[model samples]
Target: MNHDSYPDSYIRGILNTVKTIAMVGASEKENRPSYFAFKYLLERGYTMIPVNPLRAGEQILGRHIYARLSDVPVPIDMVDIFRSSRHALPIVQEALTLNPRPQVIWMQLSIRNDEAAALAEAGGMKVVMNRCPKIEYGRLSSEIAWMGVNTRTISARKAAASGGIQRLSLNRASVPGGATEAAAAAERMERERGSAG
Candidate 1:
């Protein structure tokens, strides 16, 4: 898949519009990235439905875990996947069969299936590949301060020092100031898990 296929505007639009997310493969382990991501989204006031067959009937973050996306009782704005790339297509297929259908199919970092991405896009659903909702929320929503990033401080300082002119760059590295390191580490862990599994 072409990396440029996912334009920033498209992603921003979806992120801004999505209010609820179905977290496929959400785990009970608090240390897992998916767990933290789900928690982060929930804290941000986004309704999160956990979809994990093994954890079905269990509750994580007070939300009951379902065996599959189709089991979700309410409408889902987005489907955030935490499974491997090889397993993504089936989940996308399942999400597509929903009555209202999800508006977006977000494959977490290191998890991307071209066929699945294409299918979702073809169905008028936005597709986000090789990305994490937690990371994106921090980067795009001005919530970097909560993530322990000094973007607000640094940008404010620079603007104050520059006589009220913000010189921040549009580049991802320069905007959130510097989150690539953390994002890269998360991606590495995901890759390791992918390889191990």
Candidate 2:
């Protein structure tokens, strides 16, 4: 796996598969990027565990914060490193200690450690460097595109509206650009409704 560039399928697969994410270096402040990502993924149905030594034994968004990876009670599907690049190796080493190690180790944007990625990959885990899972999820699911951000890809399929926000799925089966049968049907139905009104 190349660390410089990632295929959309690879990112989408991980995003679709992982259910539980442990965010290392998570912050309590709402203005922090880690907090924002945690909130976004949590709202999208991912179980978010905050790992911050300073805030240990406390709760962030109702989820208990643990001081270290070993402190987490349940199995983690992914370890999202919100810390700096220099701290990645030790964090990856700790993640490798898990009995059933996480399937992925994701370093946040602007945080890349080739040594950490090499170690995690050597442990048979998929490693993503210098990227944000929250951004990837939104991009692959067309959630960010709806927010007026150009994702460099176009799709005619309308997102499933929930709570007045349009959201799409990364189910892998559905093709982009309204190619899926269900998407086509929904497009037609929306057109008819527009005509009727």
Candidate 3:
């Protein structure tokens, strides 16, 4: 089956509900996409557990590295696979064995396996193939649009207001305040992205 696209609501719902994610194929190298993407999620208020069998017992971004998904002590809401397409099948297989299996299995950009995706879906886990969570989050949250990138979401809501402060949050809303506050949110995102890199 072709998985060239997914329902926005499905992806959004997953992002809204998931809190803890187990990132497989995590890398220690700061320049690696996995490294920064993991940090991006961390800064977005999600707990990211790095998983790399080769780096087991080591720490990545202050999180303990697990050798496998099953090795993670806590339940995982999602499994973010940074590995290639060929490994998706095995990875999903392992994810299914967890006591409380993850609700989602996400293969990174350039990664896709119909069989793996189908199996996970059959097991009641949502599957996202050939996509990057970092990109998805930024897109869904309209963070990229703020950078003058055409997000194609024209029906935009204003940013939310709280405690007399305006900031971009996960919820749908327009930019709350004036230039200063919008700049603040943008700067924060860039800083976190830079540091993660």
Q: Which candidate is the best by lDDT?
A: 2
Off by over 4 Å in 2: 156-164, 172-197
lDDT tens string, model 2, 6-102? 6677888899889999999999899999999999999989999999999999999999999999999999999999988889899999999997899
Candidate 1 weakest ten by summed lDDT: 159-168
Best by TM-score: 2
For residues 46-164, could you state the per-residue lDDT of candidate 3 as single tens digits? 99999999999999889999999988999999999998777889999999898898999998876777789999999999988777898778776677666775443433566444232
Candidate 3 regions exceeding 4 Å error are 161-167, 173-197
Structural similarity to truth (TM-score) of each candidate:
0.74, 0.83, 0.82
Better of 1 and 3 by TM-score: 3
| Rank by lDDT (best first) | 2, 3, 1
lDDT of each: 0.75, 0.82, 0.79
Question: Runs in model 1 with CA error above 4 Å?
Answer: 1-6, 145-197
Better of 1 and 2 by TM-score: 2
- Which lDDT tens digits does candidate 1 get at residues 1-197? 35323444555567768988999999999999999999977876688999999999999988999999988999999999999888999999998899899998998877767788899989988888778878766655445555566432124332212112322222232233444576567666766665454
Q: How accurate is candidate 3 locally (lDDT)?
A: 0.79
